[model samples]
Structures are given as C-alpha cells and as structure tokens.
Target: MMKNIQLKAMGKINLGLDVVRRRPDGYHEVRMVMQTVSLYDKVGITVEDQPGIRITANLSFLPLNENNIVYKAAKLLMDEFSIDQGVSISLEKHIPVAGGMAGGSTDGAAVLYGMNRLFSLGMGQKRLMELGLKLGADVPYCIMRGTALAEGIGEVLTPMPPMPDCWILIARPPFGVSTRFVYENLHLEKIDRHPDIDGIVRAIEDSDLEAMCARLENVLETVTIRKHPQIEEIKNFMRERGAVNALMSGSGPTVFGIFENERECRSAAEAVRERGMARQVYAVKPFNP
Candidate 1:
C-alpha cells in the first residue's frame, strides 16, 4: 500500500523587515518578523515501489523539473535519509508566484515535512529546520510556521506568541518584483528611518492590535517602492478602503493590509481588484502553526 500524505504550504507576510548590513557572503544581515497567513498551497505526496521522484503542479508557470524547489527538497531528503521508495508530489498553488510571500520556499519546506512523515523518517523538527536552511533562508521559518522573529539573513527564528487573531488582506500588483534586484539596489546608508523591530515584537507578545498597526514597517520598501511607486499607491488604496494599517511585505510588489473585520477585508480586496491596482487580493488570517 502506498503511503499518502496531504499538507498545506502556508504563505507568510513580513510585518516588519530591516536590512542590517551587507554580508561578505553576498547575503545581507536582516532583522524581521514574519507571520504565516491562511493563504496556502495544497501539496499531496504518495510513495510508491519505484526509486525515483516525480513532481507535478497545476500552475503552468511552475516548473516540475529539478529547477523546482519542491523537487530539490525531495532529492535532498531521499539522499540524506537513503530512502529507496519513489514519491509522487502534486502541488495546487494558491499563493502567488514570486510575489515575495515565500511561496516556493514554503512548498519546498512542505515536501521535506510531508516526506518525513510519510516515510516514517522520524526526523526531529530541529533536524528538519537545519536541513531547510540549505534550501533557502525563508525555508527555515516556513518549516517553523506561526509567527517568528527572524535575524541573521532570515535563518535564525525565534517563535513568537500568537498575534491577536485578525484579518490580513494581501494585494499583489500585476508585475513581479525580483528580490535580488531590490537587494542590489537597496542603500541602507541612504535609508533615514528603519522599522521598530522591538516594538513590533512587543505588540505581538502583548497582542496589542493598535500598537501593531502603528508599528508595521519594512525598510526594503524604500528601495522597492522607488522602483515601482505603484506599491505605495497600493498601500494607500488599501488603507483608504478601511485597513487600519497597510505595508509592503518583504522585498515587495505585494503589499498587505490589516483589517479588523472580514467584511471590510473583502471589500478592500474587491476595490483593489476593481480599481486595477492589484491583479490578486486575498483576505486572510494569521495561521497559528
């Protein structure tokens, strides 16, 4: 009998992000708080008698070959665990591609998690998170889920107390922003104001929605917004539509708003779409796990 496992690869939003400095390794030191949202990609895994992996996805834009992180994760697990059984992986994506939501990294983490469970690998969470780092900086946090304060180029994660449960409305413009482009152009020296990392952490731990709304910030937005001023327009639009607070997430073209009610969030989603400000708008909640 084939062992089958189903999992949800949740997307994330950066409530606060600050680039600390450029690193010798070509990576930047970062201090940020990341929160998983209800938005997700469905991942299905099935193990078979053969000894090779097969990957598939519903999205035509996604590659199913070795280039895909999901396939890369499966290869890593199989090589590390010496698993001989074949696995079939299927992905149905709800998260936007390259929208600065860690969509691909989350999918990669899901495969590592699901394969471990399906094959009875009995790997500890610590080991899985360690392995995830080899894939991408965000993969570690994706594996951890929930809310976290990430430092050290986004690999060091400190799990946070749950943020007060509320609606998160995300809007992605029709164009995609390249993270590398944003990073390369970012001039930390020129940045006048940085996000209050400690304040956001305190707000999450205290579950103070007002303080959180007041504290939402992303330093990378200084560079990204310069390249695409529409990002700022999206933030303003979301705020005007009833969001208590709105900010760009990660190295974005994708910005999100904090809403107090579902109806208001849905209304903003409709307005962003109808106004042609965003190609996609999702009303989501914080995912606690």
Candidate 2:
C-alpha cells in the first residue's frame, strides 16, 4: 500500500533586509527579519513500492525532475535515512514562482518535514534544518516557520515574538524581477541607508505595529527599483489607499502593505486588481508556526 502525507508550504516576507558585506566565498552576508504569511501551497507526498522518485505539479512550467528542489529534498532524506521506498510528489501551488518570497524553498522544506513524519524518522527541527541548509539558504528558516531573525547567508535563525495582529495585502506585478540582476548590480559601499534589523526585532517584541512598519526596509530596493519603477508606484498606491505602510518584499516586484483593518486590506487588494497594478493579489494574516 502507498502511504501518503500532505503538508502546507507557506510563503514568507522579509520585514527588513540588510546586506552586511560580501564574502570571498561569493556569498553575501545578510541580516533580515522574516515573517511567515498564511499564503501557502499544498504539497502531497506518497511513498510506495516504486523504484524511484516521480513528481507532478499543477503548473506546466514547474519542473518535475531532479532539477526540482522537491525532488532533491526527497533524495536527501531517502539516502540519509536509508529508506528504500520510492516516492511520488504532487504540488498544487498557489505561491508565485521566483517571486522572492521563498516559495520554492518552503516547498522543499515541506518535503523534508513531511517525510520525517510519514516515515517516523524522529528527526527533530534541528536535524531537519541542518538537512535543509544543504538545499538552500532559506530552507532552514522555511523549516522553522514564524517571525524570525536570519543572518549568515540566511541559515542562522532566531525566533522572535509573533507580529502584531493585522491584515497583510500582498501584490505581485505581472512581470518577474531577476534576483541575480538585483544582486549583481548592488554595490554595498554605495548604499546610503540600511534596514534596521535589530530595531525591527525590538519593535516585534514590543508588539508595535506602527514602529515596525516605519522601520520596514530592504537595501536591495536601491537596485531593483531603479530597474523597475513600478515597485515604488505600487508602494505609493497601497499607502495612499489606507495601508499603514508599504515596502517591497525580498528582491521584489512583489510589494506588501500592512493594514490594521481587514476592510482596508480588502479594499486595497480590490483597487490594486482593478488598476491592474499586479497580476496577483491577496489579503492574508500573519502566520505563526
């Protein structure tokens, strides 16, 4: 019999992101405040007598072979745990691909988490996170979902107080932003201002929404916004419509606004949609896991 397990692969937003410096190893050090959102993708995994792993997803463009992170996660667990059972993975994706929201990383994290439960592997969050880092820098944080502080190429994490109760309006424009382009063009010495990562952490601990929103910043905006001015326009639109504050998330074309009122959040979503500012928009709450 094939045993199946299902998991929710939640998306995350960066409350504040700062590029500390680039290392000789070619990886940049960063300090970021990460918050998980209610938005997620459904991931289903089945273990059976088959000899190899097979993957399927709702999106035709999503790769199902070993090139997929989900496949790599499964392979990692099977080889490490010496599990002989073959696996089949299915994804009903809702999170946008390459949206700088850690969409793919969360999906890979779900596979690691689901396999541990389905096979009764007894791997704790620590062990799972260790395995996840092998896949991607964001995978470790995705495994330990919630509000957190991420540093050291995004692998080091410190759980923080849950974000204050509020509605989040997420909007992603019709086009995609190239993360590589954003990073390659970033000159650390030229940046005038950096996000206050510690200050944002303190605001989160104090449960001060206004203070946190005011501090919300991402240094990459210098490069990304220059190439795509639409991002700044969206942020201005969200704020004018009733958002307490708004900022671009990750290396974005995706901008999110913090709204204290649910009605205001919904109205913002509708306006963004009506104006065709974004191809995808959603109103959701902060998710703590």
Candidate 3:
C-alpha cells in the first residue's frame, strides 16, 4: 500500500517590506517581516507505483505540470532522496495566485514536509529548508512558517515570536503585480525612505498591536499603489471601517487590513466585497504555525 498524507499550505503577509538594494544576481535585496495567515491551500499526496509526478487543482490558473511548484518540490526530493516512487499531488487553493501571499511557495513547502513524514525520508527540517532555498527565496520561510524576519533576497530568515492571533482582511484587485516590475522600477537612490523591520520585530515580541500598527510600513507600497490606485482606496476604506491597521502585502495589487476579531474582519471583508472593486476579499486569521 502506498503512503498518503494531507497538509495545509498556509499563506503569508508582509507586515513590513523594504527593498534595500538590487543585487548583482538581478534579485532585489530586501528586509521584510513576514507573518503566516490562516488562509491556506490544502494539499493531498499519495505515492504511486510509477516514478513520475502528477498535480491537480481547482484553480485553472495554477500550472499542473513541471511548472507547478508542488511538482518541482516533489522532483527535487525524489532526486535528493533517490526515491523511485512517484507522487500524486492535489491542491485545493484558497489563496489567490500571484497575489503576493506566497501561496505557491507554501504549497511547495507543504509537499516537501508531508513527503518527508509519509515516506520516512529522515530529512530533518534544516535539510528540508536548505532544499527549499533552491526552489525559491520565499520557500525557506514557508518551510519555517509562523512569523519571521526575512532579509537578503528573502532567503535569510530569523524566526520570531508569533504575533497575537487577529483577524486578517485581504483584498486583491483584478490584475496581478509583477514582483520583478516593482523591483526594476524602484529608484534605490531616489527612494527617500524605508521601514524599520527591527522595530516591528520588537513590537511583535512585546505583543503590542498598537505599536505594531504605528510601525506597519512597506517601501514597496509606494511603487504598487502608484500602479494600482485601488490598493490605496481599499486601505483607506478598511481603515475607515474599523481596521486597526491596513497596508499592502508584498509587491502587491493585494492590500490587507488587520482587525482585533473575526466580527471586524468579516465586516471589513463584506464592505470591500460589496464595493465590487477587488477580485477577492478574504476574512482570515494569522496562522499559529
């Protein structure tokens, strides 16, 4: 009998993101505080007799073949572990694709973690994290999960104390924002300001939501909001409707608002949805792990 395992691939929100510089490798150097959210894609994995990979997802936008991160993760593991068995991966996506929530990366992380457990691969978390870095910069943080301070092209992670459980309202517009475009357009010298990630880290440690809100900032916000005015409008609306804090997540067309409880989050989500300005609106909580 083949082993089967199920795992939840959680999404992430960047509390603060600052692009420090562009690296020689064509990737932007960044300092960001990333927090996992309760919004997730559920992935199911079952070992197959043949040595190949397969993926299925309800979202037509997600690539189901080698282009899929889940498939890439499975292939990487098979090569590293010298496994002959193939895997069947199925994703039930709750997170929007290319919405700056690191959904695909999270799915890949879940696959790597679940496969290790199901197949008794004996690869430790550290080893898995190392492998994940080869897949994407965000993959390491996804593997770690919870709250983290990410730096240096987003591959370096320092795990932080979890943020207090709160409701999250995410609003994504109809169009996608290219992370590359945002980075390329950034005038590093002309960019007059940046966020204090260390300060945000301190506030999170102290569990001070108010202080955190005061410090919630993303340098990328300027670039993204310029391109998509709806992001700014959404943030303004969420604030007026009782959000404790509102900001864009990652290089976003998706903006998020924080609330003290589910009631507030639901109310904000409904308000945003009723406006019919965004592609999607979600009422979710921060992921504990």
Candidate 4:
C-alpha cells in the first residue's frame, strides 16, 4: 500500500463570475466560468502508524493547526473513514495567497485527493467533490480542475471544455484582499452590470478565444476595485501592453490578462515587476487536468 503521496495543487482563475443572489443561508449564489491554470503549490503527505495530523508550510503566517483548511480536510477524511493513521502534510506555496485565486482551497482539495488514494478509499471524483464542499465553496471546483461552470455557492459544478490555448499573465500586488471583506461590502442591488456567464460558456465550447475574452467579467470587481484602485491600474497596464483582455479573477486583488502571443505575455510580466505594479507575476498557460 502507498503511504506517501506528492501532488501539485493547481491554482485557478475566474474567466467570468456573476453574483446571482444571496441565499437564505447567507451564502451568495454565483455563476462563474472557472479554469485551472499552470500555477500550482507543491503538497506532500505521509501516513504513519501514530494517530495525529501535522501540517507545515513555506509561509510562516499560515496556520499549522485546525484553523487551516488543509488540516480540516485531513480531519474530515480521517473521521469519515475512521482512519487512525498519523498524517503529515508539507506545502510549498507558489500560488499567491488571498489573491482571489483558489490557493488554499486547492491545497485542501489536494489533501483530500491524496489521502483518498493513499488509503485506497473507494470514493470517486463525485464523492470526493461532495466532501470537498464541506471544506470550502471553492474546494469542489479545485478537485474538479480543468475548466468548469460553478454555481450554487460553488458546490454545483459542470465540467466544461478545456479553455482555448493562450498565455495567462497572473499579477498580484503587494497587498492581499480578504474574500470575506469583499463579499460583505458587496450590495447586489447596487451592481450596475452582471457578467454574461452564458456568453462565456458558449465561447469556451466553441473554442473562441476572442469572444471569450470579450465577455470576461467579474461582478465582484465592482466591490473590489472601489476599495483598491490598484486592481484597475493593473488591468489598464496589461490592456495597454497588447493583452486581449484583463480582469480580476475571483473576488479581488489578482488580475490576469489573456494574450495570444507568448512574447507579449512575458514582456508584460517583466514590465509589471519592473514598474513595481506587482511584485508577484507569472506568465502561465491554461492547465487542464
């Protein structure tokens, strides 16, 4: 039996996100086209005879105990299966933390995925995704990876065609935006425009990059941009440098630009760093797995 597992926890981007409504349970209803990107965090897990969960990470600020979603994931699985084996997880983070990308959620998904395999649990993707929902709204999509349409507080997922091949320039400023803060400040009645999520879905199915880029929008941007103008500045910077389109991914803070040309994408990444617009920038491609 395999007691050790190593996996790449892929990051994700919101091609188009629309806040449909707020649920009675206080969760927001959303319609979004989500795509996995090449950006990822490295996660390693080991099972021992002792019974406990230990987590360590490259980021010191990251909680190593129950406060972390990853730890919660480990506990969830162990409890569900009545496994008494000790588990240790080590994370090397490359994805920007709290940048609207599914960084932490993906890491948690990775733990669920790895543990399922390591212990030879019979849970399939569908079953794993259901358990993932208990960890976080985005965890299910992270486990589903590739391209998907996410709805119903992000637990409902429909696998979509892989996004058209293109360079994705991901840039995050020195600051991080709290997803909770953005949602708390959002007033749905005040939203002037909601993204055309159906239009984006059609574009992806047809592999029409131009149409997809044209429809790229995130309703959360209205709330996020107002508080941090740098989000807009980064988008403008990318657009001025020949990007097809630039938009904030999920809630705020991280802005990704789509480019057909690799040279232009790399050039933009360099310029963003040189201008001090964002210290963390990556020129990656769509990751469909």
Give one digit per residue, the lDDT tens place, for model 4 in 1-289.
9979999999999999998999888899999999999999999999988999999899999999999989999999999999989899999999999988999999999999999999999899999999999999999999989999998898888999998999999999989888899889989998878889999999999999999999999999888899999999999999999899999989869999999989999999999999999868999999987
lDDT digits (tens) for residues 1-289 of candidate 1: 3399899999999999999999888999999999999999999999989989898889887888899999999999999989888889999998888998999999999999999888888888999999999999999999999999999989999999988878989989999899999999998889888899999999989999989889999998888898899999999988889998999988888899999999999998988888988887899999986
Candidate 2: stretches off by over 4 Å: none
Worst 10-residue stretch by lDDT in candidate 2?
Answer: 1-10
Q: Candidate 2's C-alpha lDDT?
A: 0.93
Give the per-residue lDDT of model 2 (tens digit) for 48-87: 8876889999999999999999999999999998989888
Quantify all predictions' global Cα lDDT against the true fold. Answer: 0.92, 0.93, 0.89, 0.94
Off by over 4 Å in 3: none
**Model 1 TM-score on a 0 to 1 scale:** 0.98
Clashing pairs in 3: none
TM-score against native, each model: 0.98, 0.98, 0.97, 0.98
Q: What's the true lDDT of residue 231 in model 3?
A: 87
Candidate 2 at 102: error in angstroms?
0.5
Which of candidates 3 and 4 is the stronger one according to lDDT? Answer: 4
Backbone collision tally, model 2: 0
Q: Which ten residues in a row have the lowest lDDT in candidate 4?
A: 186-195
lDDT (Cα) of model 4:
0.94
Residue-level lDDT of model 3, residues 1-289, one tens digit each, is 4389889899999999988888888888899999998888999999988989989899887789999999999999999889898899999998878889998899999999999987898888899999999899999899999999999989889989988667889888889999888887888898887898888999999998888888889998788888888888889999998999899998887889989988888987888889896878889888865
| Model 1 accuracy (lDDT, Cα) | 0.92
